[model samples]
Target: MIREITEQAWSACALRLAVDEAALRAVAEVESSGSGFLPPPSQQPKVRFEGHVFHRLTGGRFDTTAPRLSYARWDRSKYAGSSLGEWQRLEAAVALDRDAALKSASWGAFQLMGFNHAMCGFPDVERFVQAHMAGGDAQLAAFASFVDRAVFLDPLRRHDWASFARAYNGPGYAANQYDRKLAHSYARHHVPGSGTKGTIV
Candidate 1:
């Protein structure tokens, strides 16, 4: 299901936080194309296995599943077991290892991982999942909290693509050109406003 926050709410929060609304818009554009959700539920959400995360969460118990230790491990497999897509793989992984499964998939428009609940100000993973299901408002709140927790606010505010992408998307951000995408998207959506960067619209 796709979820979207009210424009008023989005703007209000961005203005209140003195965040660059355009920069946040940039993140949304790249992360979910301006929505905190995938398209309607005709199909399941996309999911990719993070083998290294699987090993780390499982304490090397499933390391053989990957057969090596490298960040490339996250992309080595497109599915887990026989299941494909986010829901299926997530459920299958949950059956085997709940916490690890939650940590595996990125969620919402910001695509915050389930393991980030605490950092996003939620007490538990369940709460984090529920927030994504709740609405775009919750998702955006979580997104805001997430960037804050990851210390990407200033980076985003300054359009410091490298720092923002590195912290938000991990060390592999470059592989996806996350920083470049953010920069390009930011320019597309940026508007002159109250703060040093865009805040309106």
Candidate 2:
């Protein structure tokens, strides 16, 4: 899904948010390391599929059990370096319950959770999944929708990495230094004269 984005698509997404390209890219970098796909000045897109989500959705009915499930991420065990494990988990979970399965996994470069469909303005998770499958435009649109829902659009517009990071990544964002990372990523990507800067505070 995220792997299908073109360079123009990225610029257009940034334009939609009325943010500097660097700022948008910076957020994306911290979220998924630019998601392995950067477009024009090409960068590869890294795709992550989570199995823990499947375990939670199916109530441990599948290969892994509840006690073993880690909501923080899924690529820890069989999910590492391959999509097959997660795909199998997803297939089984979907057979048990479609909506639950969809709600279990995060999708695309931005890692938007299936449960966030409403926040992203999708009528349903199925619709969200459909759009996500269409590639970058839908994925970025979902991300923009979330930014609006979380009320971080203003912070992003101002390059307020701290505020945006807290809202986007949650209270534990500091543990990951998401704010600091945003600043550095922005500085690395933003034009020198753009007046953009990042801060942990």
Candidate 3:
């Protein structure tokens, strides 16, 4: 996907996120197990397939019928009721409204949303995803902002894992899960330049 979107950009993004070769490799492992940039389509779930699971897992405000299955079938009217400044849109399921979110949300790589793209100054969701795929400084900046603002500096910057998870996935109840993922990432590999020589905190 990175090669298909932007060949030159991915290198730079990888460097920004990985301070060294080992760290970079570890990040790759976490991202896709050193496989192709785009995960297999089979890995993607249809809409609502996991909606109830999400609801039960987080008790979030997501509707069980929020229409998630296919990206190639979005309709316009369905876009109206979503939250203001939605993170991303389903290009196929939505009618392509100017105010509708970008298609990046459906892609779900990096777990990024359309709102994050706009906040980071990308013209649209495609641009944001392309930046990530291409591995440019812009994507790194955006990812860093998300981590610093929404993930690490929110109301739970100190130790509220729940709050951190909510920041990652909105008002959901899966903060603990996200925290565990982050912890695993940090433990299995260093957080880039989080430490020098022998320190990793």
Query: Best candidate, lDDT-wise?
Result: 1
Cα TM-score of candidate 1? 0.80
* Candidate 1 residue lDDT tens string, 138-166: 88888878777436877876779989999
| Regions of model 2 farther than 4 Å from truth | 1-4, 36-88, 194-201
Per-prediction count of colliding residue pairs? 0, 6, 20
| Pairs in clash, predicted candidate 2 | 35-46, 36-44, 36-45, 36-46, 37-44, 37-45
What Cα-based lDDT does every candidate model obtain? 0.69, 0.66, 0.39
lDDT of 2 by residue, 116-170 (tens): 8999889899998877776666777788788764368888887787898878877
Best by TM-score: 1
Task: Evaluate residue 169 in candidate 1 and report its C-alpha lDDT on the 0 to 100 scale.
Answer: 84
TM-score of each: 0.80, 0.71, 0.46
Between candidates 1 and 3, which one is better according to TM-score? 1
Ten consecutive residues with minimal summed lDDT in candidate 3? 43-52
> Cα RMSDs of all predictions?
4.2, 5.6, 10.0
Q: Candidate 1 vs candidate 2: which has greater lDDT?
A: 1
Error of 3 at 200 (Å): 15
